[model samples]
Target: MMHKPEFISPDWPAPANVKALQTTRAGGFSTGNYASLNLGDHVKDNPLHVAHNRQSLSPFLPTEPVWLQQVHGIRVIDASTSSCIETADASFSTRKEVVCVTMTADCLPVLLCDEAGSVVAAIHAGWRSLCDGVIEATVNAMPVEAAQLMAWLGPAIGPDAFEVGGEVRAQFIAQDAQAETAFRPQGDKWLGDLYTIARQRLNTLGIHQIYGGGRCTFNEPDTFFSFRRDGDTGRMATMIWLE
Candidate 1:
């Protein structure tokens, strides 16, 4: 028998046919710090356990998601194709059931789809990727206009728990001065709001119909994985497909 992981479905204004879900850190065979359901093969979680966990998840998805080798940079791939462009930080699909996915521990996971439900994308938006324009790159790649799109943010480190250096804050501020407001001073460091930053990035691209924030990975030990909270932890997957 297999355990069905408890997951969250985004309640955005997406079209009735677009489907998306975010997995929690539950329902798997891994042990120790990974404890269960670690989807990221790049992590030190046992390969067999990760494989089993991924296989178990198949029943819940349109297809096995096109897992990416995220470099925290702005590279978006056409996941509907069978090409092996492995070094992308985001992926999109115009074809049905080609589940585009991104994995994260503390970095923000963002899913986007147009109102027509013709396209869907998953993004890995760490501070570095956010500042480097991953959101903009993804929106640019979509076939629809930005205003026709909706986005959903998944679990990540909250502002109260995500402390960053001055250099990190400066980089985002350099991109858009309004990014300055997303950071609060923490001595020489800053407390960054990953959700707010991601929202602001979407807003800049004209994607205002956003949803699914406020779930903090660092604070919610039972539900999420937080690299900032635990040095060795599992990764959660956020997936989207056009039905």
Candidate 2:
């Protein structure tokens, strides 16, 4: 029997038809640094295990998720009409059962849906993508107003663990001075709070109903895979779809 992959259900009050799931580094056939439940096929994990890991999610999902070749950019695709493995950082869908998914290790994975449950999106928000406005791009692609949208941030490298050089911080501050508040000086580098930066971006877009941020992949090795902490590691998938 296949072990059921452990999932973290977002606690946000999304409408009944908007479904989402966050995978952890548990319950799969992967081994070594990949450990188990490593869904990312690009990370050098055994292709068969990666395939099995994704297959384990089949019973829970409405359909096979529209996976992306994330380049940490601002591209957002319509999952309902996209081809397989589109090179994009985010994807959203209005059609029912068209699952949109983003894989992440230390980088943040954000799931979004409107209050009416008419649309859904999954974003891969690494610092570069977030600073470059991936969230904005995803929001723009959705048919609903930002005010009607709610977001749930999945496990990511926390503020204390996500150390970055000054240039990375500068890029964010260049976009919006408010981004400065999301970082704290740590010696010559800065500890960035991805959750804070995500919230700031969401709030600016009129999406104030945000939830789920404290979980840290770097801090919880038993539960998540952190590329920063483990140079060679697995990736977790975050999925969302409208029923």
Candidate 3:
């Protein structure tokens, strides 16, 4: 029997009915680079392993998660109406037990929910989508006030590990001059802080209730599968839903 993954539940003060979980690279059937609980079937992991791994996660949720075919873009779908892997970076749900899920390796997985527990969402924020305003788009999509929404920033490539080119830095700085503060020059390239960038974006939108974001996929090899560190790697997931 396959064991369940080591899941990280958000510590944010979301209402009692709003449940969230972020899976680590543990407890599943995948082997080799996609070892253990690799949830992403698109990553060339064996379909049987992927299916069984996903199935293993079922007892933890109200329904099967609505996984996104993430393209690092800012497209959020309504979780209740979507079926089939939708081409989106984020998803929100109002209907009970409808899971909104995002798969990520080194990319940031942001989970959002209102204090009242009426809405929740999961966002896949890679550098491309992060710079493209995915966080802002998600905040705007939720029915609750931005102030009432609390976010949990999941594990990602930390500043010391995430090396970005000059162009990447320029794009963020172009959007907001203050974005320069989020980047520090490391030789010819720059060390980008996804968590800091996310906070700045969320703060600008008046969302101050943010938690999580210290874990690094690159540094913690045993706990996370970092795409930047491993070419053919598995992906963990961050999911949320209303009870």
Candidate 4:
């Protein structure tokens, strides 16, 4: 019997029809640094193992997820209409059973849905994309009012583990001076908080209902894949869809 993969269901008050799944770095076939449940194919993991890992998720989802070629940009796509893997950092769907997914190791994966369960989105928020306004782009794409949206921040490099230089800090501050609060001085570097920054962004868009944070990918080796911690590593998938 196959050991089923483990998942983290978002702990939020999303409508019963809006479903979400967050994968961990466990219970698949890829071995070594990509060990077990490595869902990303571009990380140099064995192709067959990658295929099997993705296939294993089929039972839990209504359909295959629309995996994007994330480039740390702010592009958002409609998963309901996308037929091929698109180069976008975020995807949303208003239709039922159209799964939107974003893969990340240390980068923050954000899942969003409206109070009405009419739409849901998955965002790939690396520091670069976060700084560049991926969250804002996705919110803009959604037909619902920002106030109707609730966001769930997934596992990522926590503030204590994500150290960055002055340049990275500068970019975020340039957009919003309040972003400074999300960083703390660490010698010449700064420890950045992806969750805080993400919440700040969502709040700015009138989205106040936020949940799920404090899980650290970089610090949790056994449970998560962190690109910063392990250069040659797997990726965890965060997915959402309307039922």
Candidate 5:
């Protein structure tokens, strides 16, 4: 059977050697709540089903993707040498055929590559990681010039649906006063624009070439897994590699 993969390419002009893909919550052998194509092994899904699902994705990737433990912190691991699930939110690799991957439900997955395709990275940016500087950490870990780097924002909770408390807003506001613009008043709560905040962070790091931030996982249940929508949903994977 052929597996159908949903992928988005960054709009910026990247080197022909760079390749990337984002998987949707479709086309797999998982059952029940997972249903199909659930890539997260730690999400209470059956290990056998999860293994089968991963095997299905292997043909599309050059090699096994470097999966992270994802502690929602700013550490960026060097995938070329890391063996274990490094406690980090982002990972970078200059080695060809080693895929850098990030798993997310509502959290944003940001893929990065330079103009020359010499390096590639995958970031798991939830509110905490985004506010604490995961994007900045990824950029700093890369050897490529910031101006030459391009990014693609993957599916995430839309601003209209991502309601948060004042403390969440304060976390970002404390980082950059201008971050307040990404939040909109919603009664006693605030609707946060994760995409806009990510863009601002990248722009501050000098990575202006960015794309693919319009997808809303929370609303698109058929195509994506949303943690905010379904508390125990499976995760979708966003992967990047240099060919």
Candidate 6:
């Protein structure tokens, strides 16, 4: 029996022209641990199953999304002309049919668009990328002014569950002293709030309209796939396209 995929929309007041969806682990054709709707082709899941899972998402997309070979770096690609897999953490498109997509398990997925929906972008923001300026790179790549862009944060590892070592804490602190507020001492390690860090970065960029940061992938096993919780797991996708 085939189950339908579950998706979440941003709660912020977005323009009607903008459309976005966050895929859950509920539906598709992958079996076993990948067990349906596994959109990440790079993962070790069976290639056939991954293809089927990607096909399941086609009906909901305006066009085939420009999937990037995300390398946890700060590179942003222009999806309008990109052909091959680009080593970028984010992608933006001004055309309506060129959907921007990112796959993640615990890492933050951010969808962005202008108020008029003239452009859209999808960013994969893990701690390493965030510290390296993934959010800044995406914001810079956007065609709209920072103030005119609205952002929606998708499921990620929450602060309470995202424990890290001293090196992780120092990485951000070295960039900005105020980043210390996003971390708290957990024994000899620390718990980092990726959402907060992302927000701060956006705020610094003059992007104030933000939403959807309450979900935690690591804790919500039934609804999402968490790499930290399940070592070999499928990936949920966060996608955005103009209607």
Candidate 6, 63-104: lDDT as tens digits: 888889989999998898898888889999888788899999
Q: How displaced is residue 96 in candidate 1, in Å?
A: 0.5
A best-first ranking of the candidates according to their TM-score comes to: 4, 2, 3, 6, 1, 5
Off by over 4 Å in 4: none
Instruction: Give per-model TM-scores.
Output: 0.97, 0.98, 0.98, 0.99, 0.97, 0.97
Candidate that would win on lDDT: 4
lDDT for 75 (candidate 6): 93
Candidate 4 lDDT score at position 207:
96
Give the per-residue lDDT digits (tens) of candidate 3, residues 145-174: 899899999999999999989999999999
Instruction: Name the TM-score of candidate 3.
Output: 0.98
Candidate 6 whole-model C-alpha lDDT, 0 to 1: 0.89
User: How far in Å is the alpha carbon of 238 misplaced in model 4?
Assistant: 0.2
Per-residue lDDT tens digits for candidate 2, residues 58-144, read 999988999999999999999999998999999999999999999999999999999899999999999999999999999999999
Candidate 2 overall lDDT versus native: 0.95
lDDT of 5 by residue, 14-94 (tens): 688988888888898787788689999989999998998998888788888888998888999999899877778999999
- Cα deviation at 220, candidate 3, in Å, is 0.4
Error of 1 at 2 (Å): 5.1
